[model samples]
Target: MKLPLFPLNAHVFPGGKLSLRIFEARYLRMIKERAGKEPCFAMGMLEDREGGAEVLPWATQVRMVDFSQLEDGLLGIVVEGVQWLHIEDITTDDDGLRWADCKPVSIWSEPNHEQDASINSALLSLFGQYPELGKLYPEAAGQSMDWSLQRWLEVLPIDAGNKVSLLNQLNSKPAFEFVNNLLHQGDP
Candidate 1:
């Protein structure tokens, strides 16, 4: 399937949610046309926005969850990741919006690792500090390693290339181990 690509510096993984402030004319138009008829869109990681928005190959298909007019007058919309996709080809509209031929891909799978209580505890503590982030997930996403790993990947201030490497894996084992190591970094 094909969808409009919203190249962003920050990204969302499956079961993860992100809040975006829309201000660009092209993107505003995209939302205006897409909000009701087709509330689905794909977000690709734009590693270097300074140079230009060259979207990465892999992306997450997202659906508009809610929208509102921010006090700053910009459009604020919250979206939840629906599926992972690999963009096969891209074409730019005359208005500069990008459309991509994407095929569904699965990079996150249920790892055999047992539930780590600390993962949930740590993430909940983080959410307590940032209530806004917590509001994104109304469900108990921190209850499982599969869900927690995606949140950890999205929230951590890690390198984009590192994130891409971890995301490209076939299963969530690498990401789970990576997050576990990070959470227990100072342990003897």
Candidate 2:
């Protein structure tokens, strides 16, 4: 399906939440026009290649969950990842907005195992430390393996290139290993 693109320097995986500041005229117009009628957009991580800046193929289709005007007079929006998509073709509008034709990409399915208690505890502690992050997933159960991993992906300061590679995988094992190793690097 064809959708508007809102590529960023960051990433959000399926079932993740991201808060965005809408300021550019092109995007402002996009929000104004698309909100309510559709309220979904495809977001890919921006990358600087040797030629120019480009939006990577792996993207998440997010639905606007809430919006409010911030104190700085910018539109503050909270979006939730609905599905993962691989962008196929891109076209730029006259106003510099981008639109892409995309196909759904399979990501982690819910793991067969029960929720990891350690993950739940760790995430609760994390959210406690950063209440702003807590606000993003008010409805989460804080235990499912996929949910725990996706939150870690969004929370960490990993670069876009690594994120894209992790995202492009058909399953979550690589991601699980990556996050696990990173988090437990110094542990005995």
User: What TM-score would each prediction reach against the true structure?
Assistant: 0.91, 0.89
RMSD of each: 2.0, 2.1
Q: Give the true-structure RMSD of model 1.
A: 2.0
lDDT of each: 0.83, 0.80
Candidate 2 scores a C-alpha RMSD against the true structure in Å of 2.1
TM-score of 1: 0.91
The pairs that clash in candidate 1 are none
Best by TM-score: 1
Which candidate tops lDDT? 1
lDDT of 1 by residue, 1-188 (tens): 98999988798988899999999999999898888654388988776657665677888999898999999999999988988888899999999999989999776553456677788788888888899998877675436777877788888988566787887786777887899999999999
Which stretches in model 2 have alpha-carbon errors above 4 Å? Answer: 50-52, 109-115
